[model samples]
Target: MRITRGLADIVIDSLCRGVFAGDCRRLSLRSCFPFLYDAECSKRSVVLGMVAGGDKTPHPDSPLIQRSKKEKWSQWSLRGGMQTLSEALESYIKDKGVEIHKDTPVEALERRADGRWQIKLPDGSVTADHMISAVPAAEMSRLLTPIAKPMASTLREMSASTVAVVNLEYDGEVLPVSGFGHLIPSFEDRAMLGIVYDSLAFPEHNRRSSSSTRLTVMLGGAWFESSVGDPDAVSKETLLSLASEAAATQLGVKEKPRRAIVTLNKSCIPQYTLGHWKRIDHLFSYIHQHSLPLSLIGASYQGVSVNDCIYNAKKAVQRLTGS
Candidate 1:
């Protein structure tokens, strides 16, 4: 929820592909307009609505779609995407009734001979009968003495990736395309990964009613790997190219966006693979052997969805306190 470097790594890894192997548990948040995962009241679907016959757009594979359909997910409804880490946390906090002390990152943990754990912070330390940190696996591993950090190290070794969100706003209509715009398959050698017609996808924004529109572009995987440190510049160039492509190829409006804002999310998503659970289970087993009072939770392990984070946190807490 804090959107630490590690959490971002988790999300980017999940979304950008190749961070993990096997089929991804893809959820359709593809909508003509995306609603925050918690914005169920807005009556939005979660699937990208592409203009038929506009482009060689890539979508969730037929297998996945069939699965969704068989599960009774309606075809008429749209899906939601473009959710940020902050938005996901807000929804989780609202549901769980938890209060977050912003900027209060845990600094250190001391395990007592009798077993309790004490975590130090810049403000003050909190002693807990038991503690397991949910920090970035790398930092979490590094903080511990060599012997104790191995499990965390294993978690760190699990690969991850990042994503940069580019929100381009124009005062006038630009692209000819409607629906959800387009998604580039991995086979495409282009640097830009996916383009979402934000104005067309989600109709909730005040500006959506006007010719002015917002286009959200996601450039990542190979494109993001080079710009990991300075994602802003990379995202800017990527946005321009995408805008140009849309104007010339899709929209026919070539004028640049009146305003361009880029949000660089370093290591934004998690990459989960076949053996991921084995490593986590091994870590848990080792933790149990030590009987250290600690809990680890989040999208980095177990589940990447916001619901998974909250659900697993509660379950972990219940196990810890016998609640």
Candidate 2:
């Protein structure tokens, strides 16, 4: 927090607001806090795509919390899809005799007279000694409000942003330049936030013998309010039109995409704005004071990456089992 308030603030205050002066200063701040300053100069949506965290999210509380010089900068992509990571974990957990109920929406969470927790689903209720909620904060608040009004009210104040992902497949190679892809700064005023060069990043993405290209365009975060109409109501064609136009102009793609898929993630990533630490501190303090056998984890608290979720889950299990 001191580094962000002292060093980062000093560097940012010297620069003009919402202006891209040079790569050196911007990169320097990014080196310290990747998503914070960029969103300040541009749109929050741009960096929201990079880190699951939002624009005003406190830099000190961000994924960059680990500032060790020994930290490495290596990233790996799954051959199938990011979902494979969860699938693999599920398989391993199932083998360990964990019973997982899929597609069951939790309707309510109530403390029973016997001192157990009742998890009410549409079909029935299951009582447990402890519960770990991985759902979004909003959903968690909704489930817990009946039992914990004050805590639920505070959790509701935590806001989340929605993002729409448009996956486009061209008949042949369409990217003008090579590499992973490009992220547009909000100041640039592009409809699309960024483009991930899927085929370029991983050739196996194309799969077919044909040298086709796959581009994933991310749209609608904080920009959704200004750019796209309500994401849920926005038509697939409308999203594609905006994304394709940006691609053609920026990437020099003349051919229309052979395939276009749209995925609207609603209330997906939580925004960790200024003073976020206080809210988190209060949330945990209440849980401890109440002796609530409930542990909340996932993108809402720590981070939004697959690894982040797994790390938090492991810590929660250790806390609950006392192992």
Candidate 3:
């Protein structure tokens, strides 16, 4: 597993603790921790292929993400984006010479007397000294029915929701912001959460040689359901209106987007509230006593960021491998 901070100025510091803290500090952080960062998410949002000065800074304190680096959002190409993230994971797996099964999903986990856990896939089962599960907590509870009661009970009490990503492509240059786009504060009470000037963030995307730049707008949490009832409608005009508003109010662009793509991820984000740590402690205790040799992982338990998911997964692997 690899840990990468997408935010520019941040490092692995002690930010999560502040949010987890239930005193005066936590009260102070309600607004600060979830800063409104309107940073660059695209390259075309800038001029002459130069990097925009947009600030993608996240709320200084996150309950799950580390706090040791500056918080500026950077442009990401599909290759650069996924490539940067996968590089470390691939390296670790390569060192161990493990081949991935990819699309084949696991159906069950059975622990044997020898202390190894067997993962049941569609066609067969693979047994390891212990297994790490990186699926979402809700899914894990559903899959591991024997202990599902407690897991489900705890998960239900926590708040979690999904986010929708709307991709809006245009044929012109976007007005430059500090780095990329910004996050919508919970207090804002707006349907759109934040946006990334995708083209301005990535140089390749704004290559004069290229025809158009694609912008990605994000509507997170409950906004998905509140904005539009139909997924198809949400993907279409719902995102377009928001993107158009930004372009007009922020960029002064009139030409309608040349193209658009909308991606909706159900259960995209996991919300961890006050009792997350204690609940996880108790949940893990139960798993340990049974010595089920099963590893459960995902954004649902530890965090919502990509880095958080990988970090927690690696931690599980460490304990499982005793490394």
Listed per model in order, the count of residue pairs whose N, CA or C atoms clash below 3 Å is 40, 1, 48
Query: Which parts of model 2 have CA positions greater than 4 angstroms off?
Result: 1-73
* Among all candidates shown, the one with the greatest TM-score: 2
Q: How accurate is candidate 1 locally (lDDT)?
A: 0.57
Identify the runs in model 3 with alpha carbons over 4 angstroms from their true place: 1-79, 87-96, 113-115, 156-159, 176-178, 186-189, 208-214, 230-238, 321-323
Model 3's alpha-carbon lDDT is: 0.56
Which ranges in model 1 have alpha carbons more than 4 Å from their true place? 1-100, 145-147, 172-175, 208-211, 226-253, 321-323
Error of 1 at 146 (Å): 5.0
TM-score-sorted candidate list, best first: 2, 3, 1
lDDT of 1 by residue, 1-323 (tens): 12356533444333434322112333222211122222332323212212222223233346856788789643222334435556676888878986465688777777767666777789888777766556666666766654486686787766545666677787765656678666554444234555677776665662635667778766664445543335544545654565456444545556767777766666656655446656777778988897655678866676565545657787888787798
Residue range 202-308, candidate 3, lDDT tens digits = 65646476566567776645545655454444555665677677666655666788787767766655555555667777678777776566666776665556655
Q: Candidate 2, residues 1-323: lDDT per residue as tens digits?
A: 12355433444432311122112222234322445555544544544444654455432233553633246534456788788978998999999998888899998888998768999888898889988888988898899888998889888877766677889998877677998777665556424567888888877667576788899887766567577887657888888888898888888887988888988877666666555566778888999999998898988876656666777788798777788
Q: Estimate each model's TM-score.
A: 0.63, 0.77, 0.67
Best first by lDDT, ranked:
2, 1, 3
lDDT of each: 0.57, 0.70, 0.56
**Candidate achieving the largest lDDT:** 2
- Model 3 shows how many backbone clashes? 48
